[model samples]
Target: MQQPQDQTTTLQKTFRIILGVFMIAAAVGHLSFQRSEFQAQVPNWSPLSKDLTVILSGIVEAALGLGMVFWKKQRIKVGIALAIFYVLIFPGNIAQYLNHTNAFGLDTDAKRLARLFFQPVLILWAIWSTGALSHLTKKFKG
Candidate 1:
């Protein structure tokens, strides 16, 4: 018979897996729909070529999102990767919000503004699933 705590752990893991897959699908769809828009949004002075940057960002996001399903032992690493990805894309989100730019038919300032708030939730969700609780426990262990 399974203990209550064990059941909870299983549920958490299942939720994480589902969430990870959803994230990967969203990123893939974004790449398909807005690759060119993302490339144009890249700042010219940035070190990477726009094409390379957009493609690499898509690849990294897809990999990290998928990696969450199989990289249980390295959840912390995945969390870090996801957090960094969010930070890197923050500027583009901000630009969209500021300029009210309509790319790929996302022609709404409110939606872009909402994206600024929505992305942080993903960052938090990734951290929470990956190891935020464990990290907090360690801090309080002293």
Candidate 2:
């Protein structure tokens, strides 16, 4: 009996939950066995040590992942924050490509460059999966 829009919203929420689980898994990688691989993605010029950057970002990702899963009333806000986090970390991806650092099996120039293009997709995924894009559009149109 759900309206079309309601069905779409339900799908979006489902996608957001999946994305949340994905984020949590990735955060575990950042903090555990895959830590060194993640360190290669940290920019060489970062003021913080690579390990610290990895650890801090891992913590943030875990928090954001949890928020996406449980903060229904604030999902739009969580989505926006997750999108911003994707944006903020993009420079590290860029640096990895530019420096030719090998990590996460992105061992070739082509692979690294291709990976660079996924950052925007992650940003969009975060926003879209939580209906934040629609919510923001309506807010701005008002």
Best by TM-score: 2
* Structure candidate 2, residue pairs in collision: none
Model 2 clash tally? 0
Among all windows of ten consecutive residues in candidate 2, which has the lowest summed lDDT?
A: 1-10
lDDT of each: 0.70, 0.88
Cα-based RMSD of the predictions, in order? 4.9, 4.0
Over the stretch 74-125, how does candidate 1's per-residue lDDT look in tens digits?
6666766777778888887787777777765657887778778988887777
Candidate 1 residue spans exceeding 4 A from truth? 1-8, 30-33
lDDT of 2 at 21: 92
- Candidate 1, after superposition: displacement of residue 5 in Å? 13
In order of appearance, the predictions have TM-scores of 0.75, 0.92
